[model samples]
Target: MSFNEIKQHSKARFKCESNELASIREYVRLKGLSLGLSEEEAFKVSLAVDEACSNLVKHAKKRSLSENGFYICLKIYSDQNQFIVEILDKSQPFNPNSVPSPDMQEYFKQFKRGGLGIHIMRSLIDDIAYFPAKIDKDYNVLQLKKLIA
Candidate 1:
């Protein structure tokens, strides 16, 4: 089936804030367990969700968007064999693909300041897809999916 045809099993929205990270992680972890994911698997998904939200907060601040004005919506859907988690943010439009893969040698050698969130997100999830803001729309959606074990 196509991406658009999947039925949403559950969803939740939270403000983009450092304080909300724990809540967001718990939200994803509970949903993951409900979907029959093992604790390890659920933790992996939760970490990915956490990283995404953290990155959004940083992005919003960089763009000068008010902390209270930024928000994230998370949708959990199943396609018979896997669970898909979609994270929507209305901060600033960015091309996730434009981020070059960091050279680990340099990143570690030079003591990088901040360039690992995307890497962690990619490593924890089975599949990651990003949607840029539409011509008239104000939000961008980042999708993370993990296959049922």
Candidate 2:
């Protein structure tokens, strides 16, 4: 089916494990393409989504997540002119923004081991917003938005 024939909203549930990363990226890429994103755009969004999910899975391995499901919800808001990808889990109260971006020159010079997830996500996604679980809601959300090109 072509992009114009696709629906505006969809979702998928993934386990909070590194094993699910490839599937997550594939889903995002396919859905992004069907939602009017170019192959390159879809890949970028997929990469960003992978980074986001990877960070969550890594952190989830460290702490206890009360929620069993990690969800990826996709929405195309034509009026708003955006493609939104939301990663929801009952994550602990931690802000992704707190991770400072590494200085590239220094990072390459010293050969940094790891710490580029947030940087990668931010670079590919137009906006990243974190919404903590509220009184009514039961899960923390990492919302990633990309302009519909």
Candidate 3:
């Protein structure tokens, strides 16, 4: 079925586990395609989601020795021209502006090896916005927006 057939919001909670990162990538890619995104666009969207989830898995510590207590949610919503993916993480309140974006020219010149997940994720999508958790809200949200072409 086409994405418009559903029209309702699409959302999923990706288990913050290393092994599940692949699943998250596939889910996002297929969903993007179903939403009529071009193949290249779908791949880019998936890559961005994968990078975000990979970072989450890399830093996720087992809370309370139980695996069932953790999940980073991915909520998808769309407008006429935009598909938005919002990732909700419970770890810390983050301000995306606080981190300096690396210069691609300088980074390539230096042959940087790691620590570019955020940069990559930012590049793949059309827009990104961060909303830190409020007193009532326990989880901070990272929103990735891909414009449907």
- Local distance difference test scores for all models: 0.83, 0.75, 0.76
Worst 10 residues of 1 by lDDT: 60-69
Residue 86, model 1, lDDT:
89
TM-scores of the candidates are 0.89, 0.84, 0.82
Clashes in model 3: which pairs? none
Q: Identify the superior model by lDDT, candidate 1 or candidate 3.
A: 1
Q: What's the distance in Å from true for residue 61, model 3?
A: 2.5
| lDDT by residue for model 2 (23-137), tens | 9889888878877788998899999988887877777655545655444343443223567787877766466777888898999999888888889988898888887777898
lDDT of 3 by residue, 114-141 (tens): 7798888888989878888778887777
Order of candidate numbers by TM-score, starting with the best: 1, 2, 3
Relative to the unseen true structure, what is the C-alpha lDDT of residue 19 in candidate 2, on a scale of 0 to 100? 92
Q: What ranges in model 2 sit over 4 Å off?
A: 1-8, 67-80
